[model samples]
Target chain A: MIPYLIISPYIIFFLIFIAFPVLFSIFLTFNKWNIISPMQFSGFKNYIRLFQDALFFKSIYNTFIFLAINIPLQIVIALFLAEILNQKIKFRGFFRAAFFLPVVVSGVVVTILWQQLYGFDTGLLNRILVSLGFGRIGWLIDPKLAMPSIAIMATWKNVGLYIVLFLVGFQTVPKQYYEAADLEGASHWQKFFKITMPMINPTIFLVVILSTVGGFSLFIEPYILTGGGPLNSTLSAVLYIYKEGFFYYHMGYASTLGLFFALIIVSVVVIQKKFIEKEV
Target chain B: MKKTIIYTILIFGAIMFLYPFLLMITASIAPENEISKLTLLPSSISLNSYKQVFSKVPMGRAFINSLIVSSTITLGVLVFGSMVGYALSRLEFKGRNLVFYIIIFTMTLPFQITLIPQYIIMVKLGWVDTYLALIVPYLMNALGIIMFRQYFKAIPQDLIDAARIDGCGELRIIFRILWPNALPALVTVGIITFMGSWNEVLWPLIVIRDQNLMTMPQMVTLFVLGGRSEGQLGLKLASAVSLALPIAIAYMFFQKYFIQSIASTGIKG
Candidate 1:
């Protein structure tokens, strides 16, 4: 009875915040109504329409573009920097803090900062390029370049998290393993591939899955930077849902997209668990 | 030679990481035309942009609103999330394992899955356009609970047993003994939760319409990106600075604690 008294508040909070909303959202997927009106029964129409939605496909394509460029580059850069900093450098603590600085900054600030950096006319990137005689290039304005530009920004903002992760993973690899490899006359490259690679495989796998989910859920960056502009080239799945639900008031359609997005995450996560987990 | 090369690389990477922020401060002071010119440093410094943001945008009020909501929510996580985590970890209640498993399973569910339902609930409860809408639903974080549970499980059982043997209540054992031993874990969760709430923009954008209730991030989103001044670069840049500067100052001060907190979370991804 005493324990129940203590735990009841938490149980109540969780039910209100977590359990209730989850079950309600599933029910919402089957209804056809704007949030303002009486919800009408519309069995599977929203889900059916999703198959033929061109914008949905485009958003999916854009999302994959983000993940493809960001995850590998981020992981590789983080590993390199982590390895370099791990070598007992002067100001190692300062470098670590500097590398991790971007992680603590809010997503909104990062997006704003990047938008300025990638500004077509006044952007530092183009200014440097033109000064180098590479000529000015349109970054956010060109449809082809917009999503990749967003990916670059995403990588810059988030690579810090993975750097810290890789650093932690690097520390956990006992020094004796590397010492034994050194006695075998293994090159540094060989030691990294043969010894370090397998040991940190789990961390790498986790980063990939995280970057994938985060990639698909791209919202604030594109919304703030591009507004899904230049022919919707940068429009992401979550941004699309925001438009459908909030901008267009298509609650039923947005809920359907949400369900499908959840399915994709669940399936991909399961596949990763089955295949990637075994290899690592 | 290797050490020289490593220092060079570290210096280069640090510059790359810091350049955007440097340019942000510079451009926030740059004349509107110079904004598009790509100058690395400002020709002059002015507090005009900061003044413009504070006068035009409800920045002060928004900052206060954000402070209240995030602090309240952090306290809720520390007090409530710990109790729940303690019960799950140490108590022999029915459904204990099942409850733990369910919480872990829920973490995998994307926010979109419950976006609509949560919105409707907020609407039904008359919470829209209120701080409660922003803070109440997010009061219990799945990650916070899990982090606490992991830390609690690591505590030597003898402490809890000794507390029990002394005839102290279970709540006292948790609050007095377990919590004191768990300060690191609490700080870790506290910092992350506070940061998450402070930076959250989406729900606030939808739920808080009145200018007085808007959080800092949400307010900046509307003003800077909304093309409010016929594309005034100076004004927008100033607003962006206002949005970022407080958080940046906080980060600079508490960076050591912040990094340690993130490292301790052992976030898988």
Candidate 2:
């Protein structure tokens, strides 16, 4: 009884918020309910509708496009930044903080700030391009450019986190291994590939998973920057769910989408883990 | 030569990362006409935009609401989480392993899965547009419990036994003896929880429609997205600064612990 008392607070919250919602959401996927009415059983109607939904498919496709562009860019840029910072350098703390400043800022603020920079006209990027005699390009307004533009901003906002992760990974690589490589007259590239990359593989794997999850869960960026915009080009899975559930009040269908999204994320992560574990 | 190359790269990276913030702050204070200019320096700084932010929306109210909700949630997590942590780590009880596994599972489940149903629960309970809607659901964190459990496990069992021998209650043992030793973990979890609650937008956006009850991030988003401050670039940027400034200031002071906590705990923003 005393032990139960000790753990009651967590158990109560977990039951109400975490555990119950998960079960209730599953129940919701099989029923239709708006806030004003009582829930009614709908069998597999919601799931079937999800399969036939074009916007659902498009949102999933957009999310993958985001993941494809974002994962590599984040990895390369963060690794490069981490490597540079890991070196004996002046003002390392200042540089680290500066890079990390964006990560600490709210996503909405970052999105709004980027919206200003990516504005079609009178924006910073176009202004610089015009100064350099290049034609102005519609960043957020163009269908083809909108998703990539959002991806780039997402990378900038989040790369600071992976830099810190990679920095820690880089530091854990044994210095004596580098000494041995130097004794063997190994080139810098040779040593990095042979020693650094293999050792940091775990961190790389973690970054891949984290970024994939982050990319799929993207909401505020697209929500704020483009409002899933011009042609629904930047519409993400989570954003689609938000619109369906909140905007259209398709509670059952939205819950179905939510469940599918969670399953997709879990399966992708599991598969990635298995593949990476086999390799490692 | 290598040092010069490194410095150049670092400087460019710093510029890339820090420039938006510089732009935000300067743009907020810049004369309305000068906002679109690519200069870091505002031609003539003015408080006009900030003045507009307070008048245009419930910016001050939202800030206070955020402080109340985040601090309350943080305090609850610290107290309740440590209790659960102490029990799970120190007490030999049935279902302890089950409870621990449940927490681990909950941590892996993203909030999106629970979001709609949770909103329904909030609605049924008539919690909408209330601070209880924002704060109660978040009072206990699984990560905080897990973190505290690890911290408590490091303390020797003899101390706990000695306290028991002295007729000290479990609560007293926890608060009196164990907590003092676990200060660093408390700080780490506190900062992480505070930041998470402070910067959270999605939940508040879903739960609270009343402008007066909105968190800072939600208010800023609403103020910008609702077109309430349209074409007033300085005013828009001023709202962004209002949301970012408090956390940025806190980060500056606790930068070391902030970085350390995130890195050690593997919690992302």
Candidate 3:
């Protein structure tokens, strides 16, 4: 009874916040309701609408593009930085902290800063390009550049985290293997690829899946930077659902999209596990 | 030569990570002409943009609101979350494994799926525009509970046994004996909860409409994007600096702990 009493707060919270909301979210997909109006039975209308929704498909496709660009770039860069930082280097603390500064900062702040930096006419990036005598490129204004641009910004905001993850992954690879590799006259790259890579395969898998999850939930960068603009090229899956629910107040349809998006995320993670976490 | 190459690459990477922030900070103060200039060093400094943002928006009110909300949620999670966490770890009870599994399951589920229903719940309860909407739903975090439970399990059970023999209540045992020893877990969970609460925009944006109740993240996003900054790039940047400044200072002081804790938790995630 004492234990039950102690744990009851969390149990009650889970019931109300987690358990109930989860069930309600699924139930909401079958009803048509705005916040101000009574919910009416919709009978697969919301799900049918999602199936034919072109913008919704574009949003998911944009997220895929973002994942394609972001996950690989982020992992390579983070792995590289982590390898360098893991070595006995000078001011490693300062270097890690510098790289991680953006992660700790607010995403909205980072997005707004990137918006200025990505500005075609007056942003820092294009200005530097013009100063270097290159053509000014639209970082966020062109539909072709917008999602890729956002993926770059998202990578910048989050790569610090994966760097730290890889740093820990490096420590777990025993030093004895490196010493043996050195004795066997293996090249540095060979040692890294052979000994280090296989040892940290799990970390690689973890980073990939984490990056995928992060990529799918992309919102603040696109929301603040372009507002899913440049012909809706940067419209993220989460942001689209947000607009559906809050902007248009289509609660039922929004729930349907969200349910479908969760399924996609879970399935992707499962597939990623199968592919990346292979038995070495 | 090898060290030089490594240093060069790292310095370049550091610059890539750090330059935009330097530009933003300097540009926010760079007397309007220098605002758009692609330079780290501002020739002349001005505070007019910061002044403008402050005067136009309820910056002070938002700061207070964020402080109230973040600190309240942090404190609540520390107290209640640790209580449940301690029970799960130490106390023998029915449905213990069930509670633990439920938490693990819930944490993996994305908040997006629950976003609509949570908002609808808020609306139905007339909690929209109130602090309750922000504070109550996230009053306890699963991560914090899990962290606490893990920390508790690592402790020798004899500590709790001795406390029990001394007639210490389970509540007293957690609050006095165990919690004091769980400083690292406490700090990790505290920083994660506080930073997460501080940095979030989506949840607050959905649940809060009143400008007076806006958290720092929501306030800055809306202030800039809502056209209240009125096309002044410096002012927009200034609004952002307010949001970034607290984190920058916190990170500066606690860099080691910041990296260790966030990194350790990243692996488990």
Q: Could you tell me every candidate's TM-score relative to the true structure?
A: 0.95, 0.98, 0.98
Q: Work out how many backbone clashes candidate 2 has.
A: 0
Model 2 per-residue lDDT at B77: 91
Q: Write the per-residue lDDT of candidate 1 for residues A1-280, one digit (tens) a residue.
A: 6656767886787688778877777776778878787889899888778998999889989988888899889988998998787776688888988888788777888898787678777677887898898977789999999999999888898888888888888877889999999999999879888898899988888788878888877899998998998899999988998888888878788878888888887787788768877896
Stretches of candidate 1 off by over 4 Å are B30-43, B161-167, B266-269
What C-alpha lDDT, on a 0 to 100 scale, does residue A271 get in candidate 3? 89
Q: Encode model 2's per-residue lDDT on B1-269: one tens digit a residue.
A: 87888888889888888887888888888887787674688878888999988998989999999999999999999999899999999998999999999989987886668878888899889999899999999899888999999999999999999999999999999999999999999999998899888989888888899888999999999888888898678888899999999999999998988888877766655
Candidate 1's displacement at residue A58, Å, is: 1.7
- Tens digit of lDDT per residue, candidate 3, span A144-205? 98999988898898899989988889889999999999999999889888998899988888
Give candidate 3 regions above 4 Å deviation. B267-269
Per-residue CA lDDT of model 3 for B39-102, tens digit only, reads 6788888999999999998998999999999999889889987898898888888899999999
Residue pairs in clash, model 2: none
Docking class of 3: medium
TM-score of chain A for each candidate?
A: 0.95, 0.97, 0.97
